[model samples]
Target: TLSLFYCMVGVVLVTGGSGLVGNGIREALGKHETGEEYDWVFLSSSDCDLRDKQAAVELFERMQPKFVIHCAASVGGLFKNMKNKLTMYQDNMDINRNVLAACHHMKVQKLVSVLTTCIFPDSIEYPFESSQLHDGAPHPSNEGYAYAKRMLEVESRLYREQFGHNFVCAVPSNIYGKYDNFHLEDGHVVPCLIYQAYLAKKSGQTLKVLGSGAPLRQFVYSIDVGLLLIWMLFNYNDEEPLILTSNEEISIGDLAQLIVNAWGGNIEIQTFILPTAFNLKYNAVRFQQS
Candidate 1:
């Protein structure tokens, strides 16, 4: 049996601590008032390049954490994914592989790895489920990144079955909030739109939005995801991946309008329809807790 003293003094390490989700987790930890119970360490890329196996193992040894939340990965927008498939696949695979190996080597009590809804196959049915992950191939544009993420799930399950490691995965929908990447060409949807809207409003020009703005996406607040992750750390242990998302789905056009409304609703949005092949629609299911 685990001793109460050990549990109370446990350490929790969070990788990719400088990114959007990491900021959300930090906010959630402060909101819950549980800082006194466990020592929390948030690691950014500056601390160590997780792609290096030796560096990863050394970091884990130094932290000696009881719980780990693996949020580090190579992420970018659609065009970037298409242009740099090899880099995305190689970098993410390395980070995930090394992290899992280190966690198992140290005998960590539990681990939760964050995943994206984009990893789901493009031709699958609506309302994605954990069981249908490998049903088909992902969209070609982001397949490299998707497959790498899929492998993370595979590694987690294998580790559980072969070594009995308490490793699990969390699949979240389009997550947006403070500290998000706002790069116009390389950032995700929401942040990119926000940035464009800001520039358009300031310059008094119409905002040029790519695509038909018809793709449906489900977005969850980062802080909400953070809260759920904390709950999962203590109460969730199953190997099946948990889906973290919201019920409401919004279109990109309507989403842009909302952002404009927030900024005084003075800028007009112009839709720039891309080629038929480039327009992709993502119809995600509502959030379901496992």
Candidate 2:
């Protein structure tokens, strides 16, 4: 029986188990001594299609998780977001809606959903605050994905108010680390640059970077975010979504130089200015550690 399987402790399920964030969570858990307290299950997309409500519910029933960390979403780089807005929006909305519904149906004790800083308004003030999430529209390049994520936060709050579910959301700035998507065109900035540098190093050619590389953005290590998430799972009980980010802000140009320097070999950096439509300047996220 489900209860029999977890006689000693309850199950804590993490979706997107094979992704970058999922691997971070796994690494964090490995460093801790929580194995005796909870059974951790990491699930990948191959396990089930979360966009399908029935499949999501069945997976929940099978896992019988007492807690859930929702990290699954249709995500990509700036160009991908711009080109495939509809697909991004639809897929994320479906995945989020189904997962939340299944979690509610199964009476999961607590659910922490992962969100990105990109969901904030495009023209908002620096030091993004959670309270200003919906004050204005997000950047046009990623509006579809941004709006979908905004709805996830909305649904989380609605579920909490109507059903008293302990559904929380974590908003993190640009996340980069091991196991990240390294696709040059479709991956996030850091991994994309890393991959580009690798290719440049192999070919001994100048590394080409997109845009002016002048956008200032905050980046947080996935492992650190993972550690904080585990802490939130046990201690945070409020409805307000928490912003998890580092204080340091680095321009893309400087970041690229850093990546090239880390490669050690002499590799020239060349910036390819993309259209204005592709330019996105992210301000540093302000987070006060408690």
**Per-prediction TM-score to the true structure, in the order listed:** 0.91, 0.93
Query: Candidate 1, residues 1-290: lDDT per residue as tens digits?
Result: 23444456887989998888988998988666544489888999999999999999998887888999999988998778889999999999999999999999989999999988778877766766777888988888888899999999999999999999999999888889999989976789899999999999999999998888887778889998887788778878988888887667888899999999999999999999764222222333342343
lDDT of each: 0.85, 0.85
Give the number of the best model, judged by TM-score.
Answer: 2
Candidate 2 has an lDDT of 0.85
Candidate 2 lDDT, 1-290, residue by residue in tens: 77669644789999998998998999988665544389988999999999999999998988888999999998899889999999999999999999999999999999999998778887766665688889998888888899999999999999999999999999878899999999866899999988899899999999998878887777889987887778778878888888887777788889999999999959999988875332223443343344
Alpha carbon lDDT of residue 44, candidate 1?
Answer: 96
RMSD of 2: 2.4
Off by over 4 Å in 1: 1-8, 33-36, 275-290
Which 10 residues in a row give candidate 2 its minimum summed lDDT?
276-285
